[model samples]
Target: MVTQRSSRVRLEWGPIGADRIVEPDCLAVVVDVLSFTTALTVAVQVGAEVYPYAWDRQDLGTYAAARDAHHAVGRYEAQRSDSLTSVSLSPRSLAVSSGLKRLVLPSPNGSTISFRLRDSGATVVGVSLRNRAAVAAWLDAALEDDPARVLALVAAGERWDDGSLRPAVEDLWGCGALLAGLRDRGADVLREASPEAHVALAAYDAVADDLEAGLVACDSGQELVRAGFRDDVVDAAQLDVSAVVPVLSGERFVDARRPLGE
Candidate 1:
């Protein structure tokens, strides 16, 4: 059983931290800047509904098939196979592709956190640097309508060599971007923000001048570059480029800009 806290806005890293921070009244904003959230943002912007699932699950095809969605291949597998690359977690690929109505995006960090929050009775929204501003605006609007509700920003950091949560700079930067956006739109929001939130905002302010350069120099970004996914990192670094916010509804992610029923 998770304990509910009284904070208005908080920041936490990875699933373990998120599990402790999330509560019934809390709204979860999951940030996986390296690729998962970025790809989901791009895919939703292109009218594709995404389903998040654990990367370790080998039955993602079954899960997708049950929902009549297509399961995306891993990044490395997609890179090796030209035909599969389009459905992979590459933001550029998903941004340009069409006819994929539903997709299952598997990730160890973002997807796991999202899945854990699915039944926590909280509204889950997938955010990245690409859609952070828009998401912050949407979140502000939501809070304005219900000022009592709490919000928690979870940065899904990459895993280290020992499978521990490695605090990836890209995720920290992404969290900072969202916090900064919220702070810019609503001063009162920051006044109620937790210390972690303030720290993330400070981090974002520090890298505001050259976000791309900061991402390029990050360890996770360097690893992706060496793995030939440098374009993904570049795409993820484009702050506020997307206006669409991917909100998890039911089992899939849909554009929050639309009406609830529509």
Candidate 2:
């Protein structure tokens, strides 16, 4: 659908929208609030570089070894007390670990989307409600430096039982949170936001009072809770808690506390 491109901030629902909107000059912010982006924020906060990898890939060990990074294991595998690997996609697991220099995190949603945009020459940043304000400030500064480039917020939704993309409310809320943060800074950046971004902002406003409760009730949140990951849902709902912004540089995501591309 939205084939015509514009030099403004846009909100894309899932991979399809990402495929349609992402360009060489666009800046892509991947939001996977339920887990991936949240975990990335946590990892980057502790001074770790994260490499986004697709979950379906079997050569992750080789890929991690090539990059001198540690490949993350599944949630169950990472939870074992005797497990040697400290890397995992689970935010709760990563929050407790320290001294990890590099990590290869795999996910079907956010990582897959990040991997798709790797060669597009777009500056991809992993964001969520946790660091929405920081990312918003960073993006606002970026826009001030170069108004010609567009920013696309891609909400990496979950997959359904039939393998169709099921848009998750948590990500929509996360996108809206970032958009709201940008608007709070000044209207100059807000003026560049597309209608879809406004809609997401409106959605966030409707549930801002009880963000954690809302996440706990969402489909993706419920799935995580059923899988014994309610803590992750709670962590993802914390708005503006982190100051770290994970920006994709070279092959891994680094903390962008300083100016981007520096």
Candidate 3:
């Protein structure tokens, strides 16, 4: 009997920078379960071709008007402000649709990361627990084609009064898991990862089932559950499905690009 060895993989965790410049040479995987990425993964799985627009407040009106958008959608952060109400809303279906013929996204954190990476030389992909498996497979194919030197993992967070708003550890847990799987398969290419990656992976493993057992534990996960999207979360964590890597092309997420496998 022969035993397979675990492939060595490395990953790093960090925040989006000011310019939020995403290195084009590396493959980027953006994860935000709170809403945008979560909804994006679900919507793609649900058959909606998601097109992400700029999160800049000024850009919203222009895009909405040009697209003949009927509704404008955003997060509680933007809508909570007295002046931003005209363009913000909760992360609901109506908010998802907003008033546009197509979806116009202005999220507090997720959209910012997505927009920044909009033109990186490397391919940008959306990920959440729901499409983890699919993403892993997609990554495998990318590695087979051209191994990446840097795999940037961005996590989104809330805005606080003291500028101390950082992404939740729960969010990192998922990223760590992805990093772990990437390393396990030797697909991350660069062989660079955070020392804490294993720690985060173990923590998430301990509470992986909490996604179902404690529905209200995580803010975004809970929000989706309350919004009647529990099924989305359950499916999001499945690990692998289509193996179709979802990449960001301009403003839309296109899966037509086959994995390196094909």
Score residue 231 of candidate 3 by CA lDDT: 57
At residue 161, give the lDDT of candidate 2: 81
Off by over 4 Å in 2: 1-4, 79-86, 258-262
- TM-score of candidate 1 relative to the true fold: 0.95
Q: What is the lDDT of residue 197 in candidate 2?
A: 83
- The true-versus-predicted C-alpha distance at residue 112 of model 1, in Å, is 1.3
Give per-model TM-scores: 0.95, 0.93, 0.69
Candidate 1 residue-wise lDDT at 33? 92
How would you encode candidate 3's per-residue C-alpha lDDT over 149-209 as one tens digit per residue?
4455665655555755565655676676566566567664534444444565676677665
Model 3 local distance difference test score: 0.55
Q: Model 2 clash pairs? A: none
lDDT of each: 0.86, 0.85, 0.55
Higher-lDDT candidate among 2 and 3? Answer: 2
CA lDDT of 59 in candidate 3? 65
Model 2 C-alpha lDDT per residue in residues 1-262, reported as the tens digit of each score: 5442663888887788898778887779999997899999998888788899888798989999998887788776666648654667788778888778789998989988888788988999999899989998898899889978788889899999898899888889999998889889984867767788888899999999999999999898898899888998898888889999898987789988755444
CA lDDT for candidate 2: 0.85
